[model samples]
Target: MLNRVILIGRLTRDPELRYTPTGVAVTQFTLAVDRPFTNQQNEREADFINIVTWRQLAETCANYLRKGRLTAVEGRIQVRNYENNEGRKVYVTEVVADNVRFLESANREPASGGGMREEAPQSRYGNQRSQQQDPFSDDGKPIDISDDDLPF
Candidate 1:
């Protein structure tokens, strides 16, 4: 009875936003997910998955997300069967997103030399800033932790 899916991947293209006749916002996009293992040729394989979002989330995704942006989506898989014009039956499967998390942080530093800078993280709902601070020191030093103090 469980039909849940969690995916973290890069977008294949910009999200397309539209509205239903009742004025509800809807967005559709494709995500490119890399396979866990590489092929014999040493190239990693990828799967392009179709995703759909509804309401406010859909609007937010369409407005802020772009091609190649990394994102995490939580949703359920949906499968449907249809008959084509050639009288052939086809099966379609896609993810219907319930909630989406923008994985890339918005506080990225500018790129050196003339390359594209890394994107900062953005919230889908509003511009509320994050309060969580990094555990590491500003000078790239790690926080001291002793094995004897481990909770696990």
Candidate 2:
């Protein structure tokens, strides 16, 4: 069965990191995702989705994610039930995120006033990596590629 889900939204609150009895790291956060269409009142409504990440990803999320930060989550849907203290069965549905990406840079605000050139992307893994020059990013000057360059 297929159970993959991908979502892009802002965090409703700061991530909560905790450790289990086995010393495993876990983080839980909520993502506020706005529905595609507006309601009759022309107001956009948002859904708060619970997300859980484990191990290194959990720690990474806890360290980097903050409230109202835009992020992309890739994971699967998990639904589980437990008995409450009041003898009621409570069902919980959460996304067990395996991969989470920060859409914007931690140092830069999304809507800074002054117009500035866009910077290369950064990942949670490493520092600014040197991006290979894109052939299309030049001054509209085309590189001469001879027929000999084609192996076929």
Candidate 3:
């Protein structure tokens, strides 16, 4: 069985970070994902998804990410049942983030006597080499390796 989800969207609001009773860091936020197709009026639709991050990733998201920041998240979908104040059963669904990637550099305030510089790239998996240029530049292009050339 496979249960996986990949989403690239903008945050609708700033991440809310808090610590559990045991001092475990946790963060929750909503992401606005635009639909691939347009509506009847040719307007793009968006879905607000709830995401939860834990531990170090949670702290990083809350510290760096903010409203309208584009982000890429990889995680699994979870559903749970709970009781509300009126004793009604409620079903909740959310994404439990395993990893998150900041997609854009935060705009920095201009420094005196200098132009604005791009912020340094940061990632949970260390500084990732920027692939913004062309993630699949080699696709359908000439390649030196062939199936028969494989050692396996």
What are the lDDT figures for the candidates, one per model? 0.80, 0.82, 0.82
Model 2 TM: 0.74
Model 2 lDDT tens row, 1-152:
89999888899999999999999999999999999999999999999999999998888789778898778888999999999999999999999998787765675366333222222333344335566676467577787779999898
Candidate number with greatest TM-score: 2
Range of the 10 consecutive residues with the lowest summed lDDT in candidate 3: 110-119
Q: Report clash pairs, candidate 1.
A: 104-121, 105-120, 105-121, 106-120, 106-121
After superposition, candidate 3 runs with Cα above 4 Å error: 108-121, 125-152
Tell how far residue 41 is off in model 2, in angstroms. Answer: 1.0
lDDT by residue for model 1 (40-148), tens: 9999999999999999889888977788877788899999999999999999999999978776543332224422222344445744446878545466666677998
Model 2 alpha-carbon drift over 4 Å, by segment: 107-152
- After superposing candidate 1, which stretches have Cα over 4 Å from the reference? 105-122, 128-152
How does each model score on TM-score? 0.70, 0.74, 0.73
lDDT of 3 by residue, 37-143 (tens): 99999999999999999998898889888899878788999999999999999998999999887767667332233322223446463345575877557888886
